[model samples]
Target chain A: MNTLRRSVSLIALVAVAACSKKQPPAPAPAPAPAPAPRVNQDSIDRANAAKAAAAAEAERQRLAAATAAEASRLDAARTAARAKLGMVIYFDYDKDEIREDQRVTLDAKVPILNANPDVKMRIAGHTDDRGSDEYNLALGQRRAAAVRRYMAARGVADGRFEVVSFGEQRPASPGESEDAWAKNRRAEFEITGGGTALKVP
Target chain B: MIKSARLLCVCCVCGLLSGLTPAQTRAQDTAVASGVRIGLTYDRHGKPGIAITPVSGPNADSVRAILIRDFDFSDRITVIAPDSGEPPTGALNYPLYAKLLATTVVQAVVTPAGALHVAVHDVAQKRVALVLDIALPTPAYSGDWRAVVHAAADSIEWIVTGQKGIAGTRVMYARNSGRSTQLWTVDSDGANARPVAGTENAMSPDWHPSGKKIVYDLLPDDGRHRIVVRDLTGATPTWSTGAASLNFSPVFTPDGSKVVFAAGNDATDLYEASPGSADPPRRLTSRKGSSNSSPTFSPDGRRIAFTSGLLGHPEVYITDADGSSSELLTASGFGDRLFRSNPAWSPDNRLVAFQSRINDVFQVMTISVRDNSTRQWTSDGANEDPSWAPDGRHLVFVSTRTGTKELWVLDLDTSRARQLTHGGRVQNPAWSPRLELSRQP
Candidate 1:
């Protein structure tokens, strides 16, 4: 048992010594020169510099894209607001009251008015030439007022809408038949805010 | 009678100016006043040179009284009862009697036939600074003596003023009765309305630039619309072209060489055709996948505006007559809430008025061409088919807010609107250009 133990210890010492040997003996050939430490340091420095440049380029591209997107967003909003400026609400022939079916249109207008707090509209009422001039004029006034009232109730400020009575003077359709008279009676809205955005439907 | 009429004609012309210096106005008013004296006398025929008595016939006094009353209202003339005489029996030497009247205060003589031979006297020019010979229309004393006198007085006013008198002018328009429309001609102030075309779907009338012809679209029983032009002086109407799919809303070019209209092939498009030919219509607008209709020309003929549906919705678009460089003028879904059509340009090309659909209702809207400011010219009723008056101050259109569609007029400056037609539904109005009369020189 003591001889075996001594032999194992000897093998371990031999393995460690063999692995630790740095240079191979070749009949005492010229020993190899040591490499310069600064060469490795220079390589490491170039790698770090390239990485920093890449990160800067990426940041510039991201900023340019953001600016372009912001401009596009502003243009779209402006177009939508201008389009909604002259939206009009129509009515039945000789009738000044708003119909139930027209609620959807009125609802659509609410957003436009709300978004554009400074926008003002002129609500004009028109009638066909079926009645006396004085009567049609009065009816036209009522129709315009009805639209103004509805808009005011729907969160649009009362001061935003002005009423004008064209009476029977201006007919969308100049005729003496039911078809034309039906087309003639109605109310229209003109935007008084943000310049003239009069759109014809 | 012939001699008496000539004397009345001269007096009518001179009498209109005589009242300018009413003894009261001349003495008291703070403006320039001038007066003309008119004398009535009968010419003597086949006599021993004896002056004919002016009050010979029973109708003579009545006619003279009518003339006197009319002359009193004139701005420049006054009726003065001078030496009166019996009416002559037969043919009188008119030139000789007119010469004799020159020696007295008389300026001219009137014949019973209602012809006025105004004397070109040398002394009158030196005296009143007015010397001109005017032949006036003979007034018929039998039916309405007042009418005759008024007619003579109007003639006098015309001689004094270089402006053509409105006494003989006529106004033409379209009238809607029940479901059909008819062409109508009337006096300026809604008097003597007579249907030129018996119950026909006559829409969009235009006066020939010459004012002698009217072009309109007529719909026959076949439901096809055709363009027809009628001679206002006579009865017969001649169709310039055969039936088309829908040849409605016709208007004459400013020069009267061509007619621009909207016709339906699958959709309505603008077309131009010559006045007296069957040439195939020259299409002005292409089928841009939308219904393009209601073409109107500007006064200068450089620009045109029509309703087009190119942007997925019907809207008013302005372009050159040849359809180049077209631009959308109105916003989509406007007047389209119900239905919108008919675009008319003001005479000055400064404004364009159109029908728009709002909330399922049609209304009238106008856009100023200068700054593109849009305003609702009408509200309340189903107003459509707007045509501008020649003066550009008033507009005529169709409306139906009062239970029936009728013709209406709106004065732009005053914003005053009035109903023109009482009954039936009227649509598609085109104001005629000014009319010119061929004077019997």
Candidate 2:
């Protein structure tokens, strides 16, 4: 008995909610006003036209609200996606090839970037303090380009991406240790365009 | 062209170079009377001993000390101190200096008339070989008087050897100030270091052909590196590479006409641009799947030497100024790691110096531009960023020999190196061309 009552009440509440969305509150038509005696043809037509216009206006409002809600939702998704897209990928010493261990990092960015076609990006490459600063810059660019190519292959527009190299100029860590060096040889991502609204992958 | 015949104690050479020589060899440095045989060094017999006599005045003691250090840096002359009272002003006791094995003596005085009175005495000839009255930069000890003393020492070197000393020139290097790497200038002797204005995030600095100007890679906010030049006389003009490109390692031609640099879209390639111009840069070198950078020009400006990773690792390469007739300069893939970069062509056009990876560490190496013969220079600690002094016999490079990144000047002739900076991670030293200031007061 309790289950049947709960179902009935739930259905009624849904019906009311749908009504409020479709049209603003108004008294139900009074039994067609007892078939108004000798109503003029022009008056009848005008009344129908006003009712139809009201329905159209209510439909437009519902759609505008739905669109706004959808846009904000996409904006939030893109914000989260941009953060994921910024995740860095590492490379081996003196090597620009994407390492096996770094695939997951790049994989995460690929889907985010693909889903946000309007978003442009700058992929910067960096190196440790071991090699020449100038050549390390080239090496850094190679690493950044490697990341860019990987994304392009995965459907991120190639022209939407730019690569810059910091060489050994910008070290993520300072020292000569293997750990410091490993942390420094990386390609990092930054979003350059496409504001809030983003489609989630 | 001065030929100074000095005998190196066979016993000393035996201990240092594993070769014995008697004092009789007179290991002569008979420099052809053309100019300075700037390539001479102490690794051989060295030069005749010299003495610094007493100078009278308030700053005399400090002046003498500075001059001693300057001459020592030559690596061509051995300095000595006089035992007794100053040589009688009338006649320098040539016998006293000769007996002390100091065949040469130097005398100077901070005269009351406000000049550094310098006299280089040749004990062998029983006469003074050189004399100069240098104008004093007043307030001596508190001012830039050190340069005045260095100039006097250089004059003595000129009289003793054909090569004038580099003491008066300045070095432009970048010092990492924890927050940013800023450009700085110091004497080649490592004194009077000061940061340059507007050089906050700069690196790989090179001097314009005229010592009055400098060019360096400036790191801006958008992550793109820009090529910028500043004049010591107060003009800062930028050589725009592009708004969306990576511009690395910009250096000026010896003639200061075009700025040679490395910039690229997909792969880094060498390029040349006009200073202070916004026009597109002319591409110099390109490869299908490789990166080229660190473009340095030979002294004559006829050839360009740079580093490329076309062979799967960075190696030195040489090409004509127009990027034709390219040939590999240094080929090495030690431990399967092809790490070689920072190619610096020698001022004499005889060698191209670069850093090579060996045993998992970086060391300075120079390859013969004429022949493919290579020589490893610094083996102590990780040494990189080699820049040749105007003399070509001296190279200023960054080294971790002291357990930190410090500036070091290596005298190729003597095979001896000295630290120029202490305490900070200094880098990218560019030895200025011999300027007129070194010859002035």
By lDDT, the best candidate is: 2
Count clashing residue pairs per candidate.
87, 4
Model 2 lDDT per residue over B330-431, tens place = 865345556888889999889998988888778988988776788898999889989998878999999988898888999897798887876678988888
Top of the candidates by TM-score: 2
Residue B19 lDDT in candidate 1: 9
Model 2 deviation from native, Cα RMSD in Å? 14.2
Q: Give the winner by DockQ.
A: 2
Across residues B200-232, which tens digit of lDDT does each residue of candidate 1 receive?
556557777676678887754333457778776
Q: Model 2 reaches what TM-score against the true structure?
A: 0.78
TM match of model 1 to true structure: 0.46
- Provide the lowest-lDDT 10-residue window in model 2 chain B: B9-18
Candidate 1 docks with a DockQ of 0.01
